[model samples]
Target chain A: MTAPEPAYVAVDWGTSSFRLWLIGRDGDVLAERRSGEGMTTAARTGFAEVLESHLAAVSAPAGLPVLICGMAGAKQGWVEAGYLDTPAALADIPAAAVRIPGAAADIRILPGLAQRDAAAPDVMRGEETQLLGAAAQLGEGDHLVCMPGTHSKWVRLSGGKVAGFSTFMTGELFEAIARNTILSHAIAEAGPISGDNAAFRTAVTRMVANPALATSQLFSVRAGSLIAGLSPVDAKARLSGTLIGLEIAGALSLVAEGTPVALVVSGGLGTLYKDALAAAGISPAVIDADAAVRNGLAAGARALWSL
Target chain B: MTAPEPAYVAVDWGTSSFRLWLIGRDGDVLAERRSGEGMTTAARTGFAEVLESHLAAVSAPAGLPVLICGMAGAKQGWVEAGYLDTPAALADIPAAAVRIPGAAADIRILPGLAQRDAAAPDVMRGEETQLLGAAAQLGEGDHLVCMPGTHSKWVRLSGGKVAGFSTFMTGELFEAIARNTILSHAIAEAGPISGDNAAFRTAVTRMVANPALATSQLFSVRAGSLIAGLSPVDAKARLSGTLIGLEIAGALSLVAEGTPVALVVSGGLGTLYKDALAAAGISPAVIDADAAVRNGLAAGARALWSL
Candidate 1:
């Protein structure tokens, strides 16, 4: 396996995670690095030094221009890269990148997108870049994109521009509820739930049908375990299903009756959400999030420096 | 005020609270004692001893019979009183009460109600007594009773019998999400919100309108704080209104349309829930929970010993 000449560095720096990729001259990945030194950690450990250490570990050439995204551009990050309010153009995002001042090397962090509506104000940092990369594939069309995570982002993109988005605290709420509530005892002995679990699909269907019963349905987890002898795995699946189904229902409410939906996701949650969406009668166009982010960084790099 | 001759002791032993009232022969309260030594505390220190200490504090005479309700009858309580299955008469609750074995005095703990349906199983230990007390005031009707608390219970009482019920994790979820999610920062400096806050009412109305957007509405708490200049108090209010409204909507889904609704509540939450119900366009008949539980205990005691 022979390595190609590295062209630029791409980093997705989030709240508790950091991922870096050294792209080759031909846009092929030469090397990659991942760590827990995200903005939260990098803030205290020095962002520049953290970057340099990873860059050094990957053995990237000196002065390789780097493009970054995510919480690293948040207000509390190394440098505050302010938001580009909606409806923001994907093409214009590259130019809005804020450069690290006084650095010997070129380093630019992309701005997040903010929906400044009086009724539904929202913001997203890392996902805008993913949208940029995935947009080219979506072409000239209107689309509703669901990006599942701790704080899930659902974006409405039209003709290469973002109209607006809603962020649902789906994953965070799931962890908080499952760990902190009385349902914790119900879910304690449960193993990991799969996409094929009947309990998962049933919960999703129930929530989509009557989302008003959200909290009551949650209490049923405790009740079901206590009286009906519901096993723990099924209990956890029901919880995961209820939350994910509600997210899909909420995102679907924002779009039209027949809008095309896409799921931009990676890892295990990809399957979980896919099952949930299917349970909600949706078949989204799937996009690999890893490829999306790398391509987004690549697009930003090409615009800033034609390497 | 001259104290009357005590006949029996009525105790509401909840998860974290203990309230004992000494009832006179004329069905008047001779003395009352309140403490935090509920089931959680008493389980460690001993339930009989805790009762004795409280009884001694009130200077109750020896050989007085005690009627206990709530968690003290749970499986983990001092003695497992078991449950009286739904559709059972509320008047029959006292006869089902389990007397503690080998006790000097006649100590009987009331049974809770259990809805054992596969679709919506639920149980309540303490609130059943509240229902028994509140039931007489709501005589001869098919009614939807809303008892709001940590685990809010909504009961369908048809002709003085609990037909079915649902439990909503409203208060617990409110505390968990506020303290554990990203919205925690949004609500960090928030002062306690009131029932009359416009933001609270607005949120309740919005949730009742579109219950599907429950999690998204929660995110707005953070978004509003970040971009829309929402004050911390308003943020907290919005967070609260959303949960309470969802509970109301979920509870409403279970019963028939236009069923007469009643709110049996105690403490500060009484005002807050009344405001929420009003926001949801509900003018429920209000019943004081404190009075309801006492009356329920008195009814049970009268049935058991003919005092």
Candidate 2:
């Protein structure tokens, strides 16, 4: 008879989104599900109700093991898994087995990572696991890994551990500046990441070469369009280029110069970075973040089972 | 007769704040008043009521001329002062007087500036006046004027006109990053802006040198505090330095490199720019923004009478 289906589920839950995978005994994903029951909205409907609703569709056995990551393990998550400070390895991740009273599954939440800098102590959730997963795949190399999102992370990986990392509110900054600030009207809703967009490249180079000018440069996007008749689409692209390019230049400085760095980009803006990296004379190894998270969850699950 | 009284009551209204001055024919300040009658909140109480209530304390003639600046002249103001496109001189500023019915005054609002770039068209409101003020002061010089505020403006003054200018959402960016984003807790309420904080200067220089890394470097503030025991105030200062220093570097680029440039800083953060300017090896000719605005109003008023 087929071995009783694996008794565990792995989940990657974040602020505004959630993803889950049903695993069999041998680490096979029997079924996968995604939903809007993210940490932010999970409060309106209780976390248990949200989880039960999503799990109802899955065919996992009663009383299965469920492991979760991301914001779902934060202070406000289904269960708080506390933070594990950095200089951490895979084994350093904390495992908290949370039993949902009268539920069919026992949930284990993974703790996020924290790192102390004598200059500015910092901590992070969710991305630490992704970083761990990426480091595991990369083996050993002095590299700069840029994970672009609402709050982008730039991590330096060396000697099989996270040497140091920094976070930029690049995505959030972009949104606020584009939507909430005065430049909102001049930018288009959407446009090609790269095209006959010389403004984009010029902006990127300008910021990268002279980051100090980033604040003032933003004004030029609107001025160039309004005064010189710059197309709104091109203006938007230029604005994006300026912010992203500045981020790339900033990220590059975290590691040793000429260290043969590889930008392990993971996020929606990964393609943009690939283009930007190319323009800046750097070739990056692009990794699908969703796939990487799945791989990480699987690897994490396997490690939990000591397989 | 008492210098013919003031022809008009000039107002400078802004988001979250408002200020008005009673001016005489000779540009003497008859009286001035300010209130929390900011634009954001004024919507709840009609703009007319706000104006009436604030001016209730001042005794101006019913038919006096009223000139206004700032957000009071925006499209959303009591009456919109349409934008004047750029390559515009002080004389070109549109004077489409806004008439507020049922008021004891003749309101003439000065129009803001708009500029179109063939690639990215944009516009400005109060900043145009600030630029005009800077230009008026410089008289004749190739000047790089840095105006720091919620939205920082770097104007190029050439041939006694606004050659071109750029704006950076640096202050807003800092507020959003520090108060709205994950870095909120990492920063303190306030910090020293003096040279005693070398770490602050270092972080600034680092960011100016490589702006792309801004996102990642933010995490270091937390890490430094948690691991190395950095004081919260110092951490906050470092973050501020990084942002401002980045802006100063960007503002510097509006002029030819190594050119004799004068940085005319007008804002609440003039002292902060003073420190940043010193660090960057530039001399700063600081001006009280309020004083400059008054001077600008006088110039505009004088020009209007002459016309």
Candidate 3:
């Protein structure tokens, strides 16, 4: 009989949150766990302690190799894996396995991607690997993968490589503007991700028609709610729609108009994005981040063993 | 003896800075003084102390009437001049004025403009009066006035009335993204405001072409400087250009295209904006904000006396 196959663990460590999955040799997740002990908070409690505490809740072989993505490898995270500049492929990933001092397992951190385009000055991180993972699963094709989050990533994959990618601070801007700035009063505390509010959709469509008008249009959300009797929830939805739509309009410009783009959305706001994309006449292939992260980790783990 | 005309004082009291101008019967600034003392800082040192300190610096008539604008009239300012809802005209400005209990002179604080457009849902302040001031000077015509500052305002003036306006957090966003975020390394401590840099212009044009792509492009400023040898100053300029260009493109969409727009830029960045606008094929009429403020204050003072 084949010697007992070694199990593995996968982690997606983000800015304000953390997720872990214990997988069997066959890639089946045996256990899962998450926590608010993200990269920012983990810095306070030594990285090693946080990792151990989280791992203590999950079961895996003593020496099982673990794969991790997201901010876990950021400068302020458990171990800085540095960055792998863009126009990169799956093989370009830096797999400098992070050895946790006094920990129970073997761990390998994934390196984020960075790139500099002569046409414009910009770079990317974290999402490059996820795009690579998506590319690996899809095999070969030209598709647009949009990962919406605090800093949303709109990646272009061509022939199994990240040809180019762009990021939008849509989510971060939303949070900052809504909570920290003047628009806070107009937005609701909580609401459904999608609703049938014409005013909200109209505001979004207006922005799409003229993406640059976003900063000004944001005020309209509050004005509508206060002066035109728009409900706070609806106003919030309209604000969300306007921002996301502007981002989409911006991201769509990088690709050939009417290209066969498969928008692979991976984030908590996936549902909202899907609706917005639909409104824009684009049918997206929705990918639950849970599965994508696992797939990405498995691909990364496979690549490491093969190397 | 043409009793020494009791000139009115016009003040634009902002969050962290203050500008007070003693104006004569005509729209001429007799004396001007500025201070680091603003509403945000004044909160720490009581408003009365800050006001008195500024008042002491400029010795005007014994009981000159003062017309104030900006956060000085906010809820947290020295006195709260309740928000004036939209569709409000210059004549409709509230007279209640924020009552500073023990001030050296009688103060008549001008109310900020508020609006609730059906299309959008939010109100505005201070800038509305400036737009009114701009309209007051520029006369009746369709024009877009971009006032760049901590919170930049882009107002539309038509038929000598304040049609509507939109605000962009360009200055605040630039500050946050440059100093606080990952792109901090790209910015320099100081640089020439109107450097003739092609990279900066190119970045602005690219942003104009795809406004949504900024979030991702921001990282390149750092990467280009680190790997491709882009000077920090040039990188900073490019970053500024990208954000501002995106804003201009957005603002332009709100008005008729190719409709002979005049960008009346105010604040310190006016020179840089003038250069950028020139590069973008738009001729802007640069206004001396000091003069405009004096004119505005005089007009408000005259209006008060007429009332």
Best by lDDT: 1
For each candidate in turn, the TM-score is 0.97, 0.75, 0.78
| Model 2: how far residue A66 lies from native, Å | 5.0
What DockQ does model 2 achieve?
A: 0.45
Displacement of residue A234 (Cα, Å) in model 1 is: 1.4
Model 2 Cα lDDT, one tens digit per residue, A122-165: 56677766765666667786777778777777777777667766
- Deviation (Å) of A15 in candidate 3: 5.5
Across B1-307, the per-residue lDDT of candidate 2 in tens digits comes to 4345665566777877878888876667888998888777776787777877666678776666666677776656777877766566665663444556666556667777665544324566776665656566666767777777877777676676666666777787777667755556656665545644776677777665665556556656655665566677777777777777777766665579754554555544777777677777777666567767766666676666551
DockQ of each: 0.82, 0.45, 0.39
Select the stronger candidate by DockQ from 2 and 3: 2
What clash pairs does model 1 have? Answer: none
- In candidate 1 the C-alpha lDDT for residue A257 amounts to 75
All candidates: CA RMSD (Å): 1.7, 5.5, 5.1
Q: For candidate 2 chain A, which ten residues in a row score worst on lDDT?
A: A91-100
lDDT of 1 by residue, B1-307 (tens): 8767899999999999999999999999888999999999999999989999989998999989999999999988999999999887899999999999988999999999999887778899989999999998999889999999999999999999999988999999999999888889989978889989998998898888888889988998988888789998999999999999988888888788899999999889999999999988889999999999999999999999999
Q: What is the lDDT of residue B250 in candidate 3?
A: 73
Clashes of each: 0, 60, 17
**Chain A TM-scores, one per candidate?**
0.97, 0.90, 0.88
Model 2 / residue B274 / CA error / Å: 3.4
Q: What is the TM-score of chain B alone in each candidate?
A: 0.98, 0.88, 0.87
